[model samples]
Target: MEQNTAAVIRLESVHKTYHLGEVQVHALRGVTLQIRSGEFVAIMGASGSGKSTLMNILGCLDRPTKGHYWLDDADISHMSKNELARIRNRKLGFVFQQFNLLSRTSALENVELPTIYAGIPPAERHKRAREALERVGLGDRAEHHPSQLSGGQQQRVAIARALVNHPQIVLADEPTGNLDSRTSVEIMDILQRLNEEEGLTVVIVTHEPDIARYAMRAIEFRDGKIRRDQEIEERQIAREVLPTLPSLEDADAEEAEEESKVAPGESPAKAPA
Candidate 1:
């Protein structure tokens, strides 16, 4: 692989071991990889393949048992828990499979949570949170609670929360796991725009082959090691793909028409989250 001067993440022969009641499990074994700045990459693997362990380490949520892990050329493999927490707040953003937004809180409030933890002033926090929500095309929905928004909209709020901190890399784990196909594409479009227009580095962990097609590169893991690393020759553009998908407005109209057919006092069924 060619060396990049702007390598954002580098892991050298990294390993992670877990000891569960005298049963030892090696989650990652001698995995060496480099992810450059502003690149979108997908990490694909089946269960027990160590991709989740790798993601935990990359997100600074866990440490490698052996070997070096560097973030922006700074060795972090052995950093103290407090130090790692600080670095995570300063340099990384995370989007989980669950939207993870506070259900009762407004979207803007959820996005502002990170900045509050980072010690930003109240005025600055509100400003940044609103800007982040606007960036994700959810400015009008900022006052709405998670329960009021659709699945894709809630995920967009989560993405906005991640961006409010102005981090270097966005680490997303199965971000589209909860949504329908069309909604998943909408989420990917947001991520793609962030990577292309704003030069944000994105690394997503997914099992869906079609979802991985949107990334610039793919890394496959098996038996706790990297089995394949390929630069994608033809990446799908999520923006272009969205236009070809079914419109949410049409779906809403169809649902309302169905609801009208129901007997009085019968509530409409909610869509799957």
Candidate 2:
């Protein structure tokens, strides 16, 4: 298949097979898709539906067993491991379900690690890392370690790490899996801002319909093949939806008030006299 000159990602007849002893597992079968630059895409599938495998191939972390993959007009299916690593560092950013931060390291340090691998100068790395942290609304938390921050803050730090490199595409796998409902929407808001304001291509894998609704396009995979691919007619704006959702802090405060109604060790039967 001929690659599109404008597409950031173009996969043609892509197939991935994993051999386990005598059995061969076919993960993706003939997946041909093109994602234009600055598009927000959500990949949906159940477990073992090949979405993760497709993501790995798209991110240049792994090569397809059979087929052609072009990233920005460059055919990378035949690239060596070293070449792929360089491409990944130069053009790709990844976010995983797990925060993937070092517990003892400060948030700023965690976000700065990728720049070191990218060969950024020490002074410039600090500048970019701090800018990314501030972009994610974590400037005040830069000195705190992972353990000192909440789950959402940790994920924000992870996002800052992803953005510090300023890659063309950001591939996020289940980015909101560990966050609460409100926090998940908040994370989506951040992703939406990055896509809209910075023109970054954003591709995220998520199983939740509510989460997928936030994207402009949705692609569903089933039985190792793309089952459906279509643009959303009326996409829900995360910023608009956020205001309608209940606030997590308010909910926590209400819960605390309810708990305060009763003393910590006081029984219902023993009233203060």
Best by lDDT: 1
Deviation of model 1 at 122, angstroms: 0.2
lDDT of 1 at 24: 94
lDDT of 1 by residue, 1-273 (tens): 456578999999999999998999999999999999999999999989999999999999999999999999889988999889888887898998877888679999999999988999999999999999999999998898776676677789999999999999999999888666777788899999999998999999999989999999999999999999998888999889888866764558445435523521221233443
Write the residue-wise lDDT of candidate 2 on 153-237 in tens digits: 7778899999999999999999988666777888999999999999999999999988999999999999889999999788989
Off by over 4 Å in 2: 1-3, 250-273
Worst-scoring 10-residue span by lDDT in model 1 = 263-272
lDDT of 1: 0.87
For model 1, the superposed segments whose C-alpha errors exceed 4 Å read: 253-273
lDDT of 2 at 20: 95
Q: What is the TM-score of each candidate against the true structure?
A: 0.91, 0.90
**Per-prediction backbone clash count:** 0, 0
Using alpha carbons, what is the TM-score of model 1?
Answer: 0.91
